[model samples]
Target: MAERQGIGEPRFERERQDDAQASISWLPRRLDADAAEPKLRRFGAERFEPARLSLWAMAIGRDPERPLAWLLAADHLPRALLIAGALDPRPRQDEEALVLDGGRQPTQAQFERWWLWERLARPKRWSLRVQPATLRAVALPLWLGYSRGRSGAGQERKTRLIVLSGLSGEALGALKPAVLAGLRERTKAQTDAFRSGVPEGTPEPG
Candidate 1:
């Protein structure tokens, strides 16, 4: 069983440099969702603005729960315009001097081939990004066994793009707020850690 860790503020530390700065000790809990238990897996994703957020369908960064949340809210976007974040592990350096490296893929084909396919098949040490919005956009309704009714947000669309089961509108409201908050916290933590050039304090795996 995964060790039961209490819910609390993520670990934080301050470096004694030219000035004092605080950073959260953060690392993704589960990287591969397909290999791990459902509850423990995390999706590596950030930037949750409307239709602009795209996550690795399987990348679990500091937070394991963001991917599914993103997938659920993804249909709100235009197309494959989701901002996919790459999760290349930074090299170890003196905690005070370590900087978060820029994770950018040069081309979309490269990102699609290397990050999505090869990584999925081989399970090697690599990172990029993924998205389930389109897949989920269709899959979720079918799985739930409910077609989108013509009344609320999903009205008039061919995909019947609305919830039909869980929430009041058959939607997922609760999950979004919590997941969005988690993403925000993760972003802040990463930025602070990088700015301080401190190796991350501790892994906050869920």
Candidate 2:
């Protein structure tokens, strides 16, 4: 397992398209055992957990030894939104931007579909800071929290996700074409295997 933690600053920018302001940011991978393990457990659970994939990515980014790849399945998005609302990060309907933090625990699924297209961005968009030593698959749930600015000026929504494993910068770059291609290839393979192993069109008795 990878250990050691560091705090890296994320750069965020606003991208307004079709009258919606979308925000994107990047965080480095520098995480300690205490921080990394708990995160992993929450996100790795088999329950109907709430969480933001972005928040999970941010937590991983805070540590340098974690894998660089994250899989955002469709079933777990509601959990992320509930956490976001509880933290009261305050979604901007005007700008269509909501920055969630990994601090609070959400009860309901909110903002689940706001990021449908965001899932397609799993492999290509994010830039990795550090390479992972090993890749382990685990299911962790989301932990949500909110940090309010003094005098009600602002509030920040926080979320954290612990995953099975990620790709290291070096390991990823060693693949083919480019690092992202490598990550995508690996993720795709894993997903394909998972799908293939599932019983297709099986009916469950009610």
Q: What lDDT is reached at residue 37 by model 2?
A: 47
- Model 1: lDDT equals 0.27
- Candidate 1, pairs of clashing residues: 28-61, 42-60, 42-64, 44-59, 54-83, 55-130, 56-129, 56-130, 57-130
Provide TM-scores for the models: 0.18, 0.19
- The superposed Cα distance between candidate 1 and the true structure at residue 27, in angstroms, equals 21
Pick out the ten consecutive residues of candidate 2 with the lowest summed lDDT: 12-21
TM-score of 1: 0.18
**Per-residue C-alpha lDDT of model 1 across residues 39-124, encoded as one tens digit per residue:** 11122121111111212123322344344222122222122222134332222223221122111112223334434443466464
CA lDDT, every model vs. true structure: 0.27, 0.27
What TM-score would you give candidate 2 relative to the actual structure?
0.19
Q: What is the lDDT for 42 in model 2?
A: 43
Task: Look at candidate 1 and tell me the lDDT of residue 157.
Answer: 33
lDDT of 2 by residue, 80-154 (tens): 211110111233223211122222221112222323334445454234321122111122222222222235346
RMSD of each: 20.3, 21.2
Residue-pair clashes per candidate, as listed?
9, 49
